[model samples]
Target: MNEIKKVLITEEQLKARNAELGRQITEDFKGKDLLAICILRGSYIFFSDLTREIELPLEVAFMHAASYFDGTESSGKVNLPDQNMLSVEGKDVLLVEDIVDSGRTLAALKATLLKKGVNSLHIVTLLDKPDRRVVDIDVDYSGFVVPDEFVVGYGLDYDQRFRNLKYVGILKEEVYQ
Candidate 1:
């Protein structure tokens, strides 16, 4: 069993940030073909909220690339359950992710997307954890820069739990230990 240690980000904050990011993305990609690809399982909530806030005619897709297989630590191997589900050829791709931790998964995904002949590829993550980053990858838009704590909620999970929480929170240390 686990408990929320403290709230890292409130729901209101998330809503406001999403709206801001949406506006920025809308402005940047105005009059251009945009395909927002949601990195599945973890980023579905953020992608849904953020995409809805984007007042632009854009398409959406999903990709399941994960490095953490039911654990807090990254296994350093990206697992792509379905890779060829969408076509990104000659389209501006907006990769939506829940958190940018080790950067391994995103780097791999970015490379794969680029190889498929995308016009451009930009990353947008709900949370940015630079402290734990191993691969240097750029995040075009970031909602929050969090510390090196085990965070959960807002679609981020611990053992596939706590993802439905409305706000982001830190999980108790003992829970994962």
Candidate 2:
């Protein structure tokens, strides 16, 4: 992966697609009392832009859950927050994520929410990596479906290195070495 190709998704491309996603979300939850549940760390940037684009009245909540501890791999165990700031019981909950790789996190979160008596549950992800899927999860709205390669930037990362990259890129394997 040392041979770097050009940026896969430019900053302009990301902005345009994000705006489109925002418009769709705004239209879908027009009159309903929308509550956006954003996954922490990774999805914070995407959530910020998407929620702002949403014109309808809504509330925002955050949950910190992560499992990746090694290089390009997830621990496959999700840790829920001890003190959740937002209550979604009997409310329309839309879970927003930065990317869907293994999908274990979202699937687990959705199941927990359903068990807690959430009235409605929806999922929105900025990127989808179908090739790496280990658990079944449906994305109601997605901005892009990425290839099976290891990617970084636009909020995705490797040991938290490339989150600040404006454009998504296929990382050089040597970087990981």
Best by the lDDT measure: 1
lDDT (10s digit) by residue, model 2, range 1-177:
343445788889888988998899898888887889888888888888888888888988888877676777778888777334557788888999988999988888888888777778999998899889999888999989988777788787888877888888888777776
Q: Compute the lDDT for candidate 1.
A: 0.94
lDDT of 1 by residue, 40-121 (tens): 8999999999999999999999999899886689999998877787799999999999999999999999888888999999
Model 1, runs deviating above 4 Å: none
**Residue 83 in model 1: lDDT:** 77
Q: What are the models' TM-scores?
A: 0.97, 0.92
- The whole-model C-alpha lDDT of candidate 2 against the native structure comes to 0.83
* The best candidate in terms of TM-score: 1
Q: How many angstroms is residue 126 displaced in model 1 relative to the true structure, after the best TM-score fit? A: 0.3
